[model samples]
Target: MTVYALETSGLTKQFAGFTAVSDVGLRVRRHTIHGLIGPNGAGKSTCFNLLTKFLAPTRGTILYEGADISRAGPAEVARMGLARSFQISAVFPHLTALENVRAALQRRRGESFDFWRSDRILKRYDADARALMAEVGLTGWEETLAGEMPYGRKRALELATTLALAPKMLLLDEPLAGLGQEDVGRIAALIKRAAEGRTVLMVEHNLNVVASLCDVITVLTRGKILAEGDYAAVSANPAVQQAYLGEMAEPAHV
Candidate 1:
C-alpha cells in the first residue's frame, strides 16, 4: 500500500481566467491527522472539493492509495473508502439519531429501502448504527430527534452517519466552525480516537485545534501551499504568520 493516504502534485484550479488554487501540492501520510489551515477564501474548501470529486482540477494529479481519484465522481471516490463532512452540518433533522444512522448503514449495505423488512432484518442495521452512535457519544441520544440535538451533538450525529460508510480516509471541513468550547473538545477527542490507522485531512481556521490534532500541517494561501511541516516548523514559518495576520503563535518571516 502507498505510505501516503493522499498526494497531489501541481494541482490547480481556475475560474474564468482567475486562478483560485495554483500549483498546490500536499502529501498526507497514512494513519495520521493532517491539517490544512488558511484564511477565508484561501482555496481551502476548493482544494477539498477537488479531493472529494465535487470539482475538477484544471491541472495536476491526485493519488489516493497510489490510484488517481481526481477525475472520479463523488460516489466512486466514496466507495474507494473516502468520506467527507461538509462545513455546514449534513444530517437528517426529522429522524431520530438511530434512524438517521440506520439510513446511512442501509445505504452502505446496498439493501433496498424495504420499510417492510421484518423487524428482525432491520434490527441488524439498528445494532450497527447504535454502535456508531455510541462511538460518537450519542449512546444515550439514540432515540432523540436529530433536529432536537444541540449544534455540537448534531455534528457528532453527522460524523456517526459517515462512520456508517466504514471509511478509511476522512476529509473534514471546518469541523469546529459553530461549536462551543465543550462541544469542540468532545468532537476533537472523538475524531482523534477514531483516527487510529485512518487518514484524516482537515481544513481548520483555528490554528490551536490544528496544532494539537495534526501530525503534519500544510499552510495554504491564495490557492497554493506556502509551507508544510510539523507544528513547530510550520508555525515558525514567516509566510504562514504573514498569511494568518500574526494571530498564530510564531512570528512571520520578513
Candidate 2:
C-alpha cells in the first residue's frame, strides 16, 4: 500500500461562530493524485487554504513527511515543498512567457532579478526557464507576451511557473474551473505530466477529471468528510448521494 506524503487529521476552520471547515481528515499518497469534491461552500477551498497556510486552522494537525506542519505560514510551507495553484490562473501579463518562468526560477534560486546584472549573465536562468517551459509544452511561445498568449497556453505557463518552484506536493485548487473541454484536456495532460514523481491533491468539481485522474477521492459536505475511497466506492456511498450526488447526478440518473 502507498504511504501518505501529506495528511491532515481533524482539520478545522472557524469564521466567528460559523465553522467553515470541520475536521477534514485527508491522506494524499506519495506520487498519486487525490481529489477533493463537494458543492460550493462545502469547505474544499478552506481546507486548501489551511494546507497552504493561508488560513490558520481552528483545530487539528497537518503532517508532511511524518512531521507536523499545521501552523507553518505560507512561505514556510512552500519552502517545505508544498505549493498551491489558484483557481484563477496567475501570471505576469507584461512579461514574456519565458520571462515569467525565469522570474519564478530566480525566486526559487534566491537570485536577485534586478537590472544590475548584465543581459549575458541571465542566460543560465533563461536556459533553466526555457527547459521548464518546454516541459510544459510552451517551447515556441517563450518570447510571446503572456497577455498575448491564448488562455490555455497562459495556464500552461502558470503550471510551469509553479513547477519551477520545485514543489514536492502540489495543492491544485480548481485547476479546470472556467476552461472549455479542449483547454481542460490540455491542462489536464499538463497536470498529469507534472505529477510524475510527486504528490498532488486538488479540489475539483469536474467528475470526469476526478474520475479519470485521481487515485483516491475525498468527498466533503457541510465542512466534513462525507466519504472517501476510490471513485466508485465514494460515489456509491449513501450520504454522498444525499448531500452531493443529488445535485451532481445526471438528470436521467436523478
- Measured by TM-score, the strongest candidate is 1
Estimate the TM-score of every prediction.
0.95, 0.94
Q: How far is candidate 2 from the true structure (C-alpha RMSD, Å)?
A: 2.5
Q: Candidate 2 residues 1-254, lDDT tens each? A: 33888888989999999998997778888999999988778888888888888999999999988879988888888888988899888999998999889888887887776635777876678888989999989999999999999888888999999999999999998998888888988888889999999899999888878888888989888899888898778777778777864754432120
Could you tell me how far off, in angstroms, the CA of residue 20 lies in candidate 1 after the best superposition?
0.7
Residue 65: error of model 1 in Å?
0.5
> TM-score of the candidate numbered 2?
0.94
In terms of lDDT, the poorest run of 10 residues in model 1 is 245-254
Model 1, residue pairs in steric clash: 238-252, 238-253
Each candidate's clash count: 2, 0
Candidate 1, residues 1-254, lDDT tens digits: the string is 77999999999999999999998888999999999988778889889999888999999999999999878899998888999999888997888899889988987887766666787877788888989999999989988998999999999999998888899999998988899878877888888988987899998876777878899988888998888888889888877788878777563331
lDDT of every model, 2 decimals: 0.87, 0.86
lDDT of 2: 0.86
